[model samples]
Target: MSERVLMKGNEALAEAAISAGCKCFFGYPITPQTEISAYLSKRLPKVGGVFLQAESEIAAINMVYGCAGTGTRCMTSSSSPGISLKSEGLSYIAGADLPCVVINVQRGGPGLGGIQPSQADYWQATRALGHGDFHVIVLAPSTVQEMADLVTRAFDLADEYRMPVMLLADGLLGQMMEPVVFKKREENGKSFDKSWAANGHGGKRKHNIINSLYLEATELEEKIHERFKRYDEIKAKHTMAESYMTDDADVIIAAYGSTARLARTAAEKARSLGIKAGVFRPITLYPFPVNELREATKTAKRVLVCEMSMGQMVDDVRLALECKIPVDFFGRTGGIIPKPEEILEKLKGV
Candidate 1:
């Protein structure tokens, strides 16, 4: 049986991680995401788990790396600036192929920008997160319920692929309150497979290696190619997205995260004014549901990429549409959220 309860998105993420059998959490408190750390600080202890408030974001990510090395489900979270500090550890974890979850409740910034909700880190989260030829499975949640659900799914995907997963949320989704129905705890006595884990090998195994370094160049190239192949498989299987009224629309809106919520509202308003509009929300940011967008653009004349950043996702939309349709961009930066009225106006002009 499932029960529904009103919860903030940050609290929901922490609760869902615990419910998903995560036993370790290390994070630093930062604006718009502080509640996550605070909630875990109190809840993890009761569940026989460990939650540590590290001195800095760098320390927290490294702590997660260490816990994940033991084959335990571990996580760390931060906002934009803090995520930047953890980039080195992120690259290391990706290189080592350690399974872990990293949540980024995005805020505006190239520097220490404002704390208001912004999806300006779309490029950072999807592409340039760390200096390496690596990709992290990125999930975007548009609602508090999806925030919880996606956190659990992120952990599952991380463990399944032995790679890092990122829950790419924004300040609006993090702070909003909504009703969520959580899954019942797994009671089949299941557990993570730890054959590759560095948890002190007994007499059965002679040695264990967790480092990402391969001294031979050919070996490293082979490993990298294998990783990319795995990513391709994930892209085929895990591209999640939602389409609303896109079947017969002239203009379609492509958005994700919290911006999708606003776009949905805007699309509804546009429809009321007798404008044919639809919305496509990418639940997975990295794989990006490009095929879906490509199909939608087959009939649609224009696609307006609505985001909280300055046209980052627009690039993806253009690539997906393959210049078959015109892709326009509407966005606001520096922690400013685009309003539904503004989006409607942009649609009117289209």
Candidate 2:
């Protein structure tokens, strides 16, 4: 077993990306997540990796797109507004079918909101991250350990699907310190078959072109349909969630990312108070874990969806349960983190 190390979440994420074979990182510094870039700038070069602090968020994402086109494992990180600035570049990468990793350590939202912890980007990540009929695999990690572990998973999924993957974390997770055991790095050197990559082909093979442009309407439509089919496969296979003491619970709490940690403790408190409450945490925000969510809430009479945003994920939870059980919401927006006692009170009322 690997020895556990005490580290902040952002630094742990940076180290894990290196272990996942990410050779290039292009990003801009932003509050709450700046530690990630600061750590990578020093450590990436030591591991023979490239780390560049692009002048702007737009430049950073485009750099990732260019590196990804050459079949290199690359990534970028930012806070909420920075991610919004990279939206066009993100769409280009997705349209070109390039594999890369993106990290969003969220702070308060809309326009330069405070530098406090927030999950307001949940809608942006799972839905409308970039324009058009494309989706990025979104992973939400509740613990500092999961913050490290999911980087490898994000890169692997990106490579497998030939698309971008986003690790949706919040300021709390990015800044918190915890003990984490990084798994042994599996050396799968040059494992992906990237014949489609635009890297210079030898004289023997035709030059491969990486592009997102389809001038003709029919051609563009056909390409979109093909991408949607791949999306279907991803939805079927990769949805993930964690259910805690939910077998016979009367009330179930649905939450994700850092907020799930609070929900878990609230559930425990409810149990101690003799209320049958459990937590159903979705690990994948994009695929939504519909089936797992349904299973977790099977015996639940009421479902309480909690968030650090104003009722975003609650809609998904209600839709997933098909409104068979009454669904309610409790939230603290603009960087206010709801306490476990608050969630417990909500659970009791439900």
The backbone clash count of each candidate, in order, is 0, 0
Q: Compute each candidate's TM-score over C-alphas.
A: 0.97, 0.98
Model 2 CA lDDT for position 141: 92
Best by lDDT: 2
Query: Quick one: best TM-score, which candidate?
Result: 2
How many backbone collisions does model 2 have? 0
User: How high a TM-score does candidate 1 get?
Assistant: 0.97
Question: How big is the positional error of residue 137 in model 2, measured in Å on the Cα after superposition?
Answer: 0.4
Per-residue CA lDDT of model 2 for 244-278, tens digit only, reads: 99999999999998899999899998889899999
Q: Which 10-residue window in model 2 sums to the lowest lDDT?
A: 184-193
Candidate 2: residue 339 lDDT (0-100): 99
Candidate 1, residues 1-350: lDDT per residue as tens digits? Answer: 28899999999998999998889999999999999999999999999999999999999999988888889999999999999999999999999999999999998898999899999888988899898799999999999999899998899889889999999999999999999988876682245566788888777886667887889999999999999999999989999989988988899999998889889999999999998999998899898898878766566899999999888999888888789898898998888999999999998897
